[model samples]
Target chain A: MSPVSQTRSPLDWVKTAISRYWGVVGVLIAWQAWVTITGVNSIVIPHPINVVGDLVFNPGVYLANAGQTLFLAAAGLILGMALGTMVAIVAWSSRILSGILVPLGLIFSSVPVVALIPVLARLLGYDVKTVLGIVIIISFFPAFVFTAAGLKSLPPGSSDLFKVFGASRWTRFVHLVLPSAVPNWMIALRLSAPPAVLSAMLAEFLMGKSGLGFLFRQSATEFATERAFGTSVIATVISVLCFTSAVAAEKFINEKWK
Target chain B: MNAPLSSAPATAPEAWAINVDHVGKTFTLDGGKELKAIDDVDIKIGQGEFVALLGPSGCGKSTILRLVAALEDVSTGRVTVEGSNPTALSRAHRLGVAFQDHALLPWLTIRDNIALPYKVAGRPVDDKRIAELLALVGLSGFEKARPRQLSGGMRQRVSIARALVLKPDVLLLDEPFGALDAVTRRHMNVELQRIWSEQRITTLLVTHSVEEALFLADRVIVMSGRPGRIIKEIQVPFARPRSPDVQRTMEFHHLADELTLALEPEGHH
Candidate 1:
């Protein structure tokens, strides 16, 4: 509110950077230690070294597949988050809407969507549209539920404050309800991201070319367990990266709006 | 007699700022039960009058204030502000409110918090008005300070300044000083009186403390429970520019005790 300096001090920068990477550093060191001590078969858990070599040198044979998977997941996640927030606004605005959306969303979520892959293939034709649709369906409901509940959960006094001010519907969405609901949205996104990634993978496995899932299916056919294992690790790292970035973005928004 | 508020405010009383007539509210519990929060509330508050809706907890004192502020609707009657229906008063700058909690946005600094209504309505922040508000609330030096950086009393002061920045026709304060320590609350009471007198703004405060209600209000309306309704109205014959010393006078206690007795349990009566 005040005219304060925009830049962080050097000490503040160091603190922020360390906090962000602390888990990553711990994971690397622990992973190296585990490889040295376990002496397990390389097929089950390739040394982090071999995984990194494949990640860098093979430079995305599977990574390219991973890139495609990431694209689908990212697109699906964004569509889901945006549309989910809008659904929440609708649900919150009218009791009738909540009633309608509740049963619709529940039924949508029930009946394992993975089972409908062939239906989707029949409709959208075995392609990325089909894969992203899977991600959208898997990712959207939780976001919608949380966003709706979060908006509705604003403290009595807060809503009253907005009401007294005669705030526009959109204004309340952008200001009062949105800022207060950041924590809930973050929790939903964390819950939804892994499934969204998995959904994309499943769709890719079922559908076609270019994705870590395709690599996974191909490697399984060849019985190259190490490559499959490596691909799995790479997939995991991608998920973590995606989830972490989403979480960090949420945290930054929370802090800025706090 | 529940009715929508009218948008017409083409003409209004030169004397009174708020008018209520048998306005009431009741909430239906989850199982289709009803809880009466307020009932048959009627009051004609003059322009620039400092009044308190005082009663014990659950007496619906706060509910009355919220109704006038247009935060909630009346169940069976009507309420108006500046001779206009509050519910239909669609402008954001018309009423300034401060509640028990400061409710200052933690993200914004003291100045921005004060300047928020303007900025939120797409009007640019008026720096001069912001500075004047900060100076008035004794937050002049901390304009850039975030709500979290300030102490409790300091935060409440910022809240007050924020409410005042818009120069609202009425100021609705719901136990604004209740959360502060003894000393800070007393100091704020004095500061509030000064601001009220200087601005000549109509104020409606809801409070449980008899002395606090007595010290601040020009007239205090006491209410009774369950189906909450006004039980008595007592006038504070005290002089203007209220200071802490005015609290020690016999007249203050006389009114305080009268309001307190009105709020006591009905069995004893």
Candidate 2:
């Protein structure tokens, strides 16, 4: 029916696919070339093939570690986002509370959060709970800031309309403020997803009994380069998955809420 | 159209639908100096009357409407609605208002936007009433469309529908068609007249357009610039169910010219 439908060809399909995935193809080509030309020690940097082989042969180990890391990240992300949103609601209710906490949130967000991982591990005793806590603290700031902004950024005159309608404070918050804040909340989710995974891995790498970060550490210590590379690959895959899902979620909400 | 309430009862003491008794509004500037926006402005609207406050920009016409809508407190004097404070009327969900911006909620459909006042009043959503309002505003088929999907005039109609969904005792319109183009504005004015004729609610409209004031209102009050005060008042002679042809009459043109002259800067006329 359309010109594009009529002119479409297999070559066009190949061109579209290459345009979409050029970065991945380029990276793989570069990796293989480097491995072939350098003739470097496999112990330091294993071939991509060897890493793939390790992933295929040790699926159980990768799966278990990935599951732990994902669970920790997802659980921590949910807890952190919930706490942040609750605090944002509280801030919205009281100008004095917003004044007190908004500056504190800004300061904490500006600080290097990862630098506090070791201190937190030492203080909280280097357990899985501490790892979860680390991820939560890292993810909390964006949620707070974005949700706070969204709560205040109402449609012009709609606030006055609400007031003139004699809306109770609770009704205004529920019907107007909460819906207004959803798009910004989704933005916070998308921005925080990768950090959630990264922070979970960092926390585990610092000190944890199990997870991908712990697996990488154990493999590196044992001089199993292929297994270490496999863990890195799996972490990359999980982070990408989390980020993409969050982006998709944000898109869905923006369509409905905007 | 329903007949306006008889003048006999309206002539009784303290029987006005809205009473702005010597109201004055002063705003404090950033450096602590005060700017008076309106000075000793007095206005009263009878039950079922449509009164338009015609003024130049920054003349505080909107401030008058806002006071009656309970969106702002009167800086001086008293504003009463039906023998009580404006706040009480609003609290009872008997006040409706539409602003120039047509402030429909972007997240809501036209139906949901019109139904918002019910939800705000903590009442059950009346789908039939919402449907009726949609039909009244000529938006029956657009109930499921969001505000942004509609044109400017359509959005204003949706806003007007939202304002009237509760069948409020008093309606305040602050240049509700101010953002529309000239042709669309005239068309909307006709639509609004049709709609208002159906409801016959007591209304106060703030606008600067002489033709609009002449066409849509039963009484037009002309206001002067800064420190806004009512300069002149004229009872429109045209009958109800007025057609656009009335706007072309010699009487309408003469009144429009007189009002336009009154709106000019003080030394110009």
**Model-by-model DockQ, in order:** 0.28, 0.82
Error of 2 at B134 (Å): 0.6
- lDDT (tens digit, per residue) of candidate 1 on A31-116: 77897798877656667776667666776487578888989998998898888888888888899989999889888889687687
User: Can you tell me which runs of candidate 2 are displaced by over 4 Å?
Assistant: A1-12, B1-13, B266-269
- Scored by TM against the true chain B, the candidates give 0.90, 0.95
Best lDDT among the predictions, by candidate number: 2
Q: Tally clashing residue pairs in candidate 1.
A: 3
- The 10-residue segment of model 1 chain B with minimum total lDDT is B1-10
RMSD of 1: 7.0
Clashing pairs in 2: none
Model 2 per-residue lDDT at A158? 89
lDDT of model 2 at position B51: 92
Give the per-residue lDDT of model 2 (tens digit) for B70-167: 87888899999988999999999999999998989899988899999999999999999999988888988998898889999999999999999998
After TM-score superposition, the amount by which residue A55's alpha carbon in candidate 1 deviates from its true location, in angstroms, is 5.1
Q: Looking at candidate 1, what is the lDDT of residue B120?
A: 56
